[model samples]
Target: MGYVLRVRMASFFAGAATASCIGLSVLYKDYKTPHESISLQAKAFHDSLDTRISTLESLRQSEAPQLPQTTTD
Candidate 1:
């Protein structure tokens, strides 16, 4: 009788662990963005940053003040 009880308890624990694993896997899939989506998002962000940086550089160059050089005779 004791051996049978032990076996049943072990079986119950095993089932619970399996269920937990499956639940976690499903939740992870649902909550996490796919790698491809993340990659595309990051690429778009960097592209926008690049465009802003280029515009700023061009504006800086256009607005730069020219200094006159004095020649000593």
Candidate 2:
């Protein structure tokens, strides 16, 4: 009876450990998917923002007002 109880306890612990490992692996995999997607989205947004800033700079340069300069002798 003692031997049987020990074996049952060992089996139960082994099963629990296996389940925990699998759960952690699945969670890690799920975490990576969203992280990659968010990284890609952020990269795309940064690129578009850079393009917009460049365009706005060019427009500002072209439309800027020029002041007249006076010459002194």
Candidate 3:
């Protein structure tokens, strides 16, 4: 009957929605990372960049000056 078909369709939709919600919940729970780990990684990256910048700055500061030379015209 038409009524039975409608009930079956409604049930299928309800089950699908429930499964979707559960799948999302599990995904969020499994993929959550601690803030401390993120902060540590960021700090390490910042320190490395700082070291590189300082080395480059020191190299620039210590470069030899160019000398004037006579050129053939």
lDDT of 3 by residue, 1-73 (tens): 9999999999999999999999999887666655567888999999999999999998988896767998999
Model 2 agreement with the true structure over 1-73: per-residue lDDT tens digits: 9999999999999999999999999999999999999999999999999999999999999999988989999
lDDT at 47, model 2:
100
Model 3 CA deviation exceeding 4 Å by range: 34-73
- Top TM-score prediction, candidate number: 2
The TM-score obtained by model 3 is 0.47
Colliding residue pairs in candidate 1:
none
Q: Which segments of candidate 1 are over 4 A away from where they belong?
A: 34-43, 63-65
Q: What's the lDDT for all of these models?
A: 0.94, 0.99, 0.90
Best-fitting candidate, scored by lDDT: 2
What TM-score does candidate 1 reach?
0.61
State every prediction's TM-score relative to the real structure: 0.61, 0.83, 0.47
Count of clashing residue pairs in every prediction: 0, 0, 0
- lDDT at residue 50 of model 2 (Cα atoms): 100
Pairs that collide, model 3? none
* CA RMSD of each candidate after superposition: 3.1, 1.6, 5.3
Query: Which scores better on lDDT, 1 or 3?
Result: 1
